[model samples]
Target: MNFLVYAGVKLFTLLLLMLAGGLFLKALDRLIFPEVDFAHELREDNEAVAKVVAAAILAWAIALALVLG
Candidate 1:
């Protein structure tokens, strides 16, 4: 139905927004966490940076969600 299609489109848009936000985070991660190398920490499986990145993404998602609403 139309509602189902609209929901699907919204979900897809959310997915894309998350992806873009993550990339934005990565791009700014260095300036934000200059003490740590984002890509290196990621490859070495560093939990600290992981959490920081997750938080940034969540913050971004929340802001985006608010705007979308």
Candidate 2:
């Protein structure tokens, strides 16, 4: 049906947008904290770094939802 096709397209678009936003955040993270290695911290079981990463992801998702809604 036409509705199914439309829904699929919208889902794809949303996925693309999320990918772009994540890449932007990765770049921004490196720019802001040049010395802090997020991957390394995460591998070493750093809770504080994990929390910060989660917070950043949640903030981005909320902002994206607000914009798309």
Candidate 3:
């Protein structure tokens, strides 16, 4: 019962964190590229933009891992 409760809480927390991260990223996107349409780029399948975004995300992940480690 304790394990079940713990697992449920952990799942909820992770989902919440992911949503918050996405919102934060959106804000960052707007601030960094106010003139850019990230959604449009994604829709048009822009690989260069995608690659840059992916690299930014990976860098963030690495920094997060390092801090959390």
Candidate 4:
């Protein structure tokens, strides 16, 4: 039960971090490349951004599991 609680908390935290990171990256891209079309880039290839967010969440989950376990 304690492990479960810790995992849940860590998962939630990781998700929030992923979301914030995604938004921040998007904003940064827009600010850096105002002339470039972000929406088109995202539509053309979402895998890049998805991979980043997924990796962050996965890393956090693994770290939390190792520390909590």
**Off by more than 4 A, model 3:** 56-69
1-69, model 4: which lDDT tens digit per residue? 999998799788767866776687679768977886656755778777567556766876686567555
Ranking by lDDT: 2, 1, 3, 4
Cα lDDT of model 2 by residue, 1-69, tens digit: 999998898788789989999899889879999899999999999999999999988998898788767
Cα lDDT for residue 17, candidate 4: 64
Winning model by lDDT: 2
10 residues in a row with least lDDT, candidate 3:
60-69
Q: For residues 1-69, what per-residue lDDT tens digits would candidate 1 score against the true structure?
A: 999999898888888888987777777876777787877987899999789767866888789889667
Model 3's lDDT to the true fold?
A: 0.80
TM-score of candidate 1 against the unseen true structure: 0.65
Best by TM-score: 2
Query: What are the C-alpha RMSDs, in order, of all predicted structures?
Result: 2.6, 1.3, 2.8, 4.9
Question: What's each prediction's TM-score?
Answer: 0.65, 0.85, 0.73, 0.58
Better of 1 and 4 by lDDT: 1
- Model 4, TM vs. native: 0.58
Clashes of 1: 0
